[model samples]
Target chain A: MELNKEEKAMASGELGEAVKWAINHQIKVGNFFDAKNFVSVSNVHMMIDPESVGIDGVLFLENLVGMGAKVKIPMITDPRGVDLNYYTPLGQTEEMANIERRTIKACTSMGILMTNTCVNYQTIMAPIFGEHVAYGDTGVVIYSNSVCGARSNYEGGPSALAAGLTGRTPRYGLHLEEKRIPTKKFLVKFKPEELTDWGLLGALIGKISGSYWEVPIIEGINHNPKSDELKHFGASMASYGSIPLFHMIGTTPEAKNYSSKFLNRLDDHIITLDDIISLKSQFGKKGDKIDVVVFAAPQLSIFEMQKVAELCIDKSFKVPVIICTSPQVYSDASRMKLIDQIEKTGAKVLEGTCFYNQYAREIGLANGWKRLMSNSAKIVNILGGYGYEPSLSSMENCIASAVAGEIV
Target chain B: MKTLLKCHIGIGKKVQGEVLSANDNFSARYDLDRLKGIFSRPQHKLVGKSYVDKILVLNESKGGVASAWMLYEMCARKMAPKAILFNKANTILAQGASLANLTICDRFIDGDITSLLSSGQRVTVDPMNGLVSIL
Candidate 1:
């Protein structure tokens, strides 16, 4: 890896211990990927939930803070693990909350913004086409790269922090022009009618594409999906496949450009109604008693919040219903009385934390929440391993099932 | 039988350890119960196996960027695998391995690593040189 003068300075500790550690880390990753040089990134988003970070990560951040580490660019955070205001009721222990506090303080000391959102592209600044950024959260990376036409690899908490401190990342993977081109193609025979359907479609494509190296181009989508629909689609795709970027013909930018430049043919798999059913068959079925219902994964957009509240109005839930939204959206949802409406249905609203990252296994054990239901395809896929028997359906169906206390 | 395998240059140090091979994909967050050091995912092939200190071999990395930080935390607790070998690795695993200083390599020139290696096999992994010797 070739380092510039500034990078050399950082590596040499002329800048600070934080920068030195950050640069060296970047170089290690860069050398592994055979990166030739560093590319300047405009924004960096780091994921630092307490469960993922644990005691060691918190201490690592504190050490960096003790070194007077400060981000060189606008550095934001993904959803936190513990919502300090609402954890105990959800069966989160004090130790988990303390870790959250320490992690937050360490990151805050480094001048990092606690955006606490995976949907930063929606509530925060959406990176423009051709923009370069270091972003954490698979959902965020995939959405920014595929929909916004920005470039980023799946920058984990450490790599994103390194990029934040240095304002650059190794120029490999999605940063290279060649890596963004489509490697696989799919044609959908059925039009997805709901957000869950969109998520199912995305997951199927992601599974078929198989890995980070394969870029999939999807076709047969003739309608412009709402931002929330695309959000679920991208989130599930990244969750299932570890896929960073995908091109939707006529929907995403550069889909045509890259396909025209690189490929003569795009004949691939054809997706149909049976394929969606086959995918759904693996999850829990109707009549399965649900212990909890959640609306999370990528924190709810304000629009999604409004929609959820509409279904939740005057409804009484037999099982616990948890709704997670970004701090930015939480405020708006509160102001609009959407949160109150959801809460009136015996639901809980958690701010600045996604369901999966929030000590999911511990909380599930504490609450005896063995069977879970959610509209987010991403969350359902994740919680299965976290000891929850997760079921997926439309938002309306999920809410109805919550009221029934079983998959309806 | 003894054999040598060549792979793409990887991260971390040279080390030899027993192998635990699975054709299934991996995710430290989604597929692991780190507290127990076992693959806790009910659907996974290696659901009950201990990953600690073995050369954990799998098909590829699944999603979840949290695996990057979780890897370091796993190592700090002394509950991490000594190394991880995959048919292919995503950016998250690569970055995680770098931060944790754990041996991780993928893209074997010979064939799929899961097919080449098996549980309880002894192997020496030279990540820097992209070589693994099965014994």
Candidate 2:
């Protein structure tokens, strides 16, 4: 990979050991992908939850801080693993919380913001068309690339940190124009009516597309989806298939520029309502006993909080119900009394932490929560691997089932 | 007899280990029980199988970015696969391997790495040279 003068300087340790390490790491990744050069990225978002980072990753961050590492551009974080204010009651150990504290301290020492959100595209700043960013979290990358017309690949925590240190990423994958074109085409026969429907549709498409390299161009949706709907769609798709970018005809920004010829003779798969139903049907049966109900994955936006609050009014949950939202939305929700309304019915609204990445197996064991139900398809898909018999439903139904302590 | 398979040059050190091959896709956050060092996702082909110390051979990577960091965390606890071999790896797996310094190679010139390798087979992986030898 060709390095500019500044990049060469960083690689040569003229900038510092921290930056030299960052540049060398980027070079290894760039060479692996055959990147020609580096592209300046506007921002960086990192996913470094304590459960993922562990003690080793935290010590690594501290070492970088000791080396005087500071971010070159605006950098933010994904959801934290522990909601420090509310971890104990949710079964998180002190060791876990201590790890979280150390990680946050190390990050802050390096000038990184504790945005603590996977929904940064919704809650923080949405990247504009043709903008380049190095963002962690598969959901964030897919949303920025597909919905906002930004360019990014699935930058994991380490790469995002490297990008933050250098303010640039390798010029490969989604950064190049030719790679963004449709590799597969899908014609929708059924329209998604609700958030879960959209999520199911995205999950089905993602499962079919199956690889990061396959970009699916979707057609036949007559109306544009709202931001919250697209959040569930993109999040679920990324969770299911590891797909980073997608295009929806007449919906997404880049999709408007392409014609059907962009399909490049790939056969169009017709997506039907049965397909979505089949995917959802694999989870759980109606009236099954529920141990916990959750609303998170890509953390909820303020609008979603309002909707959840509306459903929670006057309803008391027999099973524990947890709602995870970004701190940005949490403050606004508190001001609007949305938090109170939702929590009035025995649901705990956790700020700045998603359910899955928060040491899910330990929490499940602590709470004895085997049969978990959630509205988010992404959460349902993830919890299954963590020893939970996850069931999927709509927000309204999830609330009602939580009240009844069964899948209604 | 030794069979040599070539692949695109990949990340990490050269090493030899037993192979744990499966045609299913992988994600450390989604399909693994990191604490147990086993494939925990019920739908996965390797469900309930231990991955520690073996070279994991899978079709492709799926799901979230947490795996990049999770790999390092797993390695820190001394409970991680010896290496990973994929037919095609997404950016996250490659980036994770880079951070964890775990051996990972993909884009095999030989068709379907899962078919080329099998469970319990001893093999040597040279990531820098993109060679895998069945021993």
Candidate 3:
């Protein structure tokens, strides 16, 4: 926490200005640590709200361009930009639209490629196995740290953009070799069988981890989930908690060899099945049958969308089932005619909107939509806050709830 | 009514003063220029209602700073909120307060003002008993 005079002076700027200074000077704080510097990177993963129009959008674009010293980084987009479509569902104003259009134009013009999707890793900008990169997308941050073995912190917007510009970020915090150590242990009694269930499990881990960064090494549990399942789990953890990196003993790049960097420490907390179930009641509520099923809180990948499409079969949806996908995936689905097929199944497939931003209950209540179901614990927890009768279930259960008008 | 403004965190000196409630949440990232035609929407009508004066806001430290800057700029253009009372001087809220033109107040305490408040649009700041009686 020691600060030199310039660092101290820079810290005094307004948050934005301070961030601007930090980006410009590459000031490093002891608390904010990183490992090694990796350079000449082209692609950058970014998370920004699309609704930041006019001044907000213009200033952000201008600053981002200026900070990079006019160098462009390949930009990966987040589908749920700014959580705006959820907040203002009636449709955005011209200004809001302009903001969105201009911001995209700026990034695109600066040579920042946009997949315009949160599933950036799958769709585009899959940073190599050992690349050092700067990214601000929250879920991507967790994924890179845990899955890809790439390095980054939940570095806020300005910092992420600056890193994209300079092709360098301070080697500290989760980027440091020492900071990646596992700080907790968990015993898995029940193997989560589905992607939705994995999210619930990750939410359980996040609850136990609280606000501290922890390494979770799991024991027991016979069932081995696929990579997509783990991606869902990691994404859920990133959204529900502030965790930047986590390791599964048998899985995960850094933990595959059981490296000392991710081994258990004294500050670690041991967790069990009771811990998992405890999170269910602690983070979510036990309630009546659901009337609507919503998905894509942090935006779903194309694979998740396909899973939803497949699971909806044989399930009679009595409730409005809302499945949100990244625009890229939506476009692909439209070209492949999967969109029409899903629409025929009576499910509304929306794009560029994450459920987190929208008022489901208000819209649902207006449309006779009541009760809700989802596989995502984060969604269940957050939607519950909005008075929706949210329940956690598998994708099948959620699809069933949508078709049957009751929680399965 | 006597109102004591305190800084829960960061660099600011506490001061006891009278009350004036200028209520609004403003965002600096929002482009005011683009909002010309969109006044029909709620987010567009933020012009006059933005209370980014010299007033001090007591809120979280981290992300709150960005939002606070918007409030600060808006208020500075009009009238500053005189001063600010913070919970922590950390970047959480301090950055925003710093961006907004206002005198920083440093002090922290907890209490309830239910027994002390008699009338006039009363806003009680939780356990801090930071009571602002609008007159």
How much of the true A–B contact set does each candidate keep? 0.88, 0.95, 0.00
RMSD of each: 1.1, 1.1, 8.9
lDDT of 2 by residue, A176-198 (tens): 99999898888999889989998
lDDT tens per residue, model 1, B19-48? 999899999988999999999999999998
Runs with alpha carbons beyond 4 Å of true place in candidate 2:
none
* Candidate 2 CAPRI-style tier: high
Over 4 Å off, model 1? A259-264
lDDT of 1 by residue, A145-261 (tens): 999999999999999999999999999999999998888989899999988899999899888888999999888899998888889999999889999999998899988786454
Indicate whether candidate 1 or candidate 3 has the larger lDDT: 1
* True lDDT of residue B133, candidate 2: 94
Q: Which stretch of 10 consecutive residues in model 1 chain A shows the poorest summed lDDT?
A: A258-267
lDDT of 3 at A325: 78
lDDT of 1: 0.93
Instruction: Tell me which of candidates 1 and 3 scores higher on DockQ.
Output: 1
